[model samples]
Target: MKKPKKPKRPMLAFAVTEIDDHTGGIVWARTKKAARIKGAARWGYDEPAYVTCRREPWADRFHSKPLPVWVMVANGWHFDCLGCGIRIDEDLPNWQDRCGADDTFRDMLREARRYRKWTPQCVIGHQHSDVFCSQDCKDADDAYRAACKRKEAHAISVFQAKVLKRFPGVTLVTDRDRMHPHAYATSRKRGIVVQQVSVEFEFPGMRYGPASLRWDSPFSSSYRKVEKPYFSCCNGDRAAFEAYAAATRRAAQEPTDRDHP
Candidate 1:
């Protein structure tokens, strides 16, 4: 028989900032130690939300000290993409040249900047701080972390060279640690990529909505057999789109509802 795994404990932590739409400040939990709630801390409005960081199993002489590289969100802060794996193919190398007249990357930044203006002005990247992790990891976790950062940096550089061309006055601002905003915008310039709530949209003359939607594409929808792909922001709008469905079912009686019955 296999041994059963033990349940993990919860840790107590604090939120460093007040996220705009979030009801409470974010929290950081350490060591899997749960904290008890008190009057204000336990109250519905004042309840303290927490996030936890697991302690690395290897605590060696090197582990005792922080790593040389900047700390990833895994250590303390929680940074993630709000719109990942959508139809963001335009940004990829293979599909780059396809979107000419309409570019989705622009739409992404614009949409990201609209409501969450606080993202650029204040949100910080993990690289800005001295918190580093051990380079000793000889596993997949280490490789994944490195790759994610590289992807972000490469994307940012591309934005600086290509996207900012139209807007001449815009310039990029980076810290020594390379930590910026999830998506930062300046007086004239804005960030390259940022996370936001899910978005859905539909263009004219499409039957089924696309899994993901982009505002612009270099490809000509008019020339193609299909006009343009449309998308819904949320999954709840399918009923509104029934008319466009390619398939439908009809109820019938015996012998295909023949009048002879």
Candidate 2:
């Protein structure tokens, strides 16, 4: 019968030792204790300080003793397979070959913490770490958003047409000035401008009732609206509009009592 083969063990490449800050070189020895003693002898001081050195790449420095459990816990260190949550033992020589968990310990810990509460899943039931499972899901989401934008554009165009028919000869100023007024007009006498005019309609969700008309005369910097029942000032009634325009023109032309002799 053939003899059973012994399992191979993993080995660490670097040893922890005190470094000479002046020279930027490691004070190395056969063991950590020996390195410490050598550091004390060279510097004439007894202090426990060490750093990792890779001068001897094949050296098995940390094989004898594993890192302390307390230190590992405090530093939030762990190795686990992301696919199955299986703990990976780095001490085994063939650990990487067995589970393929090659991510650094710190990186694995960060990923675990980030997805602790929820693991993302696609609409089709595929599990993943990203917002969608695959490119197909991402494309579908984009298409849905585009369709919503198109529907909204159609509705706005229909509303704008209605407004144009209702208020002829008025300029439609959207964009930043959407809240200013629905439509605006420039009052002219013999093709020469006299005053600025704007009209606001009473939509379904308006806070106030009836439409409103505003006018900016030479004397005022901003357009002023008449008190409630302002709709009577315009509202496509020729007689009402003529009376309101005449009153405003007279007010602008006449001087106040304060300026009279």
Candidate 3:
């Protein structure tokens, strides 16, 4: 015997009435029960969790009242296939219908034995992104980010060597300590620090760049930002600290008001 199909209900906006919070999330669903499920799922909780969902009409508008008002909320999550850019939401029939004639989604179900997502990653290192549709896309992105990071590390080392050699006493900054660039330098005036040095400054293979050097201010208890680097290296090479060194030299040579007196 052929099973009877469930009649489709009109999707409408159902407002969740809250007790304490004035603003709550507006959920769209066909029925009251569907609203509860969808809204709870959206908030990463069970249907009967903290939210006391009610069957409010679609015409209900959210207001800025003190308490017990219809509320709408959102987390700003994008549920789309990273590789193909298709809207991926298993709970929504409309979203599922778009995957017709494409078996990639089915493949996702078959292989993802533990967790199903347009969310999980292909590798441990890929945290900035997770909604890949295929292993190929994930691997490619992971490899690309790794390569770019390698380039950045290379650039950092190159900058460090240049500073240490070019300026006899100038040293490299370490992540852990606010160690001065040079041994005798006071805490108020550390020699030099490289910042925002990344491989993606070049993009493509994204091999790093636009590194800047800033010195600790002798006048104040803050690091002075270099407004204009004498030399900016997007690829993280040559003249990385030349402008900084020159500026330091110039500042040193200038006579103070005490000299005039």
Which candidate gets the maximum TM-score versus the true structure?
3
lDDT of 3 by residue, 9-53 (tens): 766666553334422455666787777677666553554354556
Candidate 1: where are CA atoms >4 Å away? 1-138, 173-261
TM-score of 3: 0.31
Predict model 3's lDDT versus the native.
Answer: 0.40
Worst 10 residues of 2 by lDDT: 119-128
Residue-wise C-alpha lDDT for candidate 2, range 113-162, written one tens digit per residue: 53344212211211112223223544755565565445434434433444
Runs of candidate 2 with Cα error greater than 4 angstroms are: 1-130, 176-261
Q: For each candidate, give its TM-score against the true structure.
A: 0.21, 0.23, 0.31
The lDDT values for all models are 0.31, 0.38, 0.40
Of the candidates numbered 1 and 3, which has the greater lDDT value?
A: 3
Between the candidate structures 1 and 2, which one is better when assessed by lDDT?
2
| Candidate ranking (lDDT, best to worst) | 3, 2, 1
lDDT of 1 by residue, 36-143 (tens): 122124323344243222343322222224322222232333332212312211122234333456668886554444323222212222222322121222233345
